[model samples]
Target: MASTSSNKSRCATCGKNIGTFTCRGCSQDFCLSHAQEHRQLLGKQMDEDVILMHDQFQQCLNEQVKQPSLHPLMKEINEWEKQSIEKIQLVAQVARQKVLNIISKHTDNVIIALTSIKEQLSRARDDDDFFESDINEWKENLEKLKTDLNTPKAITIKFDDKMNSFIPKISVHKERPITERFERFLGDIQIEENGQLITHGNSNAHATVRGKGEYSSGQRLFRFKIENKRTS
Candidate 1:
């Protein structure tokens, strides 16, 4: 009889007395009066739990679906971005090529222009040499004329008034002895401050000599001594 009472004290679901009912679906037990109500409450709670679980499962599935759908769109967007970058690079390359071509053309034109200018400059330099030669020839002719004009000479000529009008008026010459002329021409020869000998005389009697340390041949020398002449 004591074993029977002890067995009746056990819970119906888990067969242990934990002092409360637990639903079967949720692994809970109930007393005699609350058994039916507990079963009904458990059935209602199981239905609500199943609906909640289904909602969670459907949410997970919807998230998975959205992830797959977004993957293709993301791939398309990335591909479009890559394509746009490549197109931009291609356009930049073309523009760079065009700029380089223009620069090359400009450089070529500059080179050609410089070549032409160089050619013109060469021609001008050649012409300058020709002019220089002409100037040198003229200078030599002038030196020769100067030497001839300075030569001492005596001439007897009747001058007409018309010829005198065209001719330059010059002072009459004072005759001196040849020795006296020579002495006068040589008397004033002196070494200047710059160590160059300076002679003061008529154009035909002028003479000069460089200093003792400096001398060269072909330097200017003149003599204006006349021979004996009877008084007219």
Candidate 2:
């Protein structure tokens, strides 16, 4: 009876006796012409809705990329990394200069000493008669040179082969770890209608508002005051 009764339903749009199809959403019957018109109207509404959604989403993404309020930790950490690297570079430069200075000083001393020994040997060769005093002096000089060879000459800068192993081997970089943490947090932060956070299973996140009262998405997603920071 329900099926037979439904067959006799009137078109809601044209008020005609025969209906080609029934709309489940509005729960209304419509004639063929009205049904087609209704479908076209719905299709237009859907297109408009899709376009609006795409525009809003694109705007949101653009705002986040171009002018987002950068995280304080991220900025601070980047600065820290730059400063630390600069400091290390300065220290390395100082160390390198010191090494060069020591090498120059020690090399000059050794060269002068060798030159004096050479001159004394030439004089000894010229004088065939070996004076007892000269023989003793040359022997003493030779012994001194042998001792100098054993004595540590300004610690030669040979890097410890094992030093590389002792340096810190971090599995994750400083900013990289923070970025990974934020990436995981990204999944939890869902901006809902009117700039609200949507909470799902195990998500207990909250958005902090600074410098003012509550904001509503009237025209844009929310309202906020933007000011240029001035440094004195």
Candidate 3:
């Protein structure tokens, strides 16, 4: 017991006869008073490290809020969308106008024919012997009615939707009126948080995104990649 006590280190700061504690970090032996001082100094260093990390986190969050409203890729996407919608609108308008014109032509012809038939039927109902004298004429009028009923239905409006050829394809089809036949959409669209996208319209498409922090300026840099997509 005497040998073990004598071999132990003495206080580093206080030059005491014996030391009760040894610092784990620096391997320095100290009396009670000096040991407490060392612990407080280590704690201060740890607190400084924590505060530095906290400040970095807060700065990153603030930069997100201050980010620009439009990125280069975003602008490109907006232009693409605008052009696509305009094309769709033009096609729809042409189809609508054509269908209306056909309907108008048929309506006018049908009304004139029906009005003539109504006059003949009214005269026959007033005079019971009218058909008896002009049975052949009545038969001719009935044959004309049959001809009108058998008019050829040649014109029709059809919807054909297509999607971009890039990484994700967006295919749109003409949906029939909401009747019993619920025509399903032909394509799908999927987007990820990191700017990756996948879609299928007429075919498959994909996109990728990359981002980095500009350390010197505290700004963000972004890049986008697209594949197999046609803008319009």
Best by TM-score: 3
**Which residue ranges in model 2 land beyond 4 Å of their true spot?**
1-60, 63-75, 128-152, 156-232
Clash number for each model: 4, 0, 17
Q: Which scores higher on TM-score, 1 or 3?
A: 3
Per-residue lDDT tens digits for candidate 1, residues 1-232, read 1123344445564555534444546564555556676677768987899888999989878887878755667889989889977876775676566545555554564566556655655776787644775457546655654453343122112334555564332222222212212222244354443432344443444464432322265453444433342233
Candidate 3 worst ten-residue window by lDDT: 175-184
Query: For residues 39-113, could you state the per-residue lDDT of candidate 3 as single tens digits?
Result: 898889877888778888788767656764465567799899999888767766777776566656666766787
What is the descending lDDT order? 3, 2, 1
Candidates 1 and 2: which is better by lDDT?
2
Q: How far is candidate 1 from the true structure (C-alpha RMSD, Å)?
A: 34.1
Write down the lDDT of every candidate, Cα atoms only.
0.51, 0.59, 0.59
Candidates' RMSD to native: 34.1, 36.0, 29.8
TM-score per model over all chains: 0.24, 0.30, 0.32
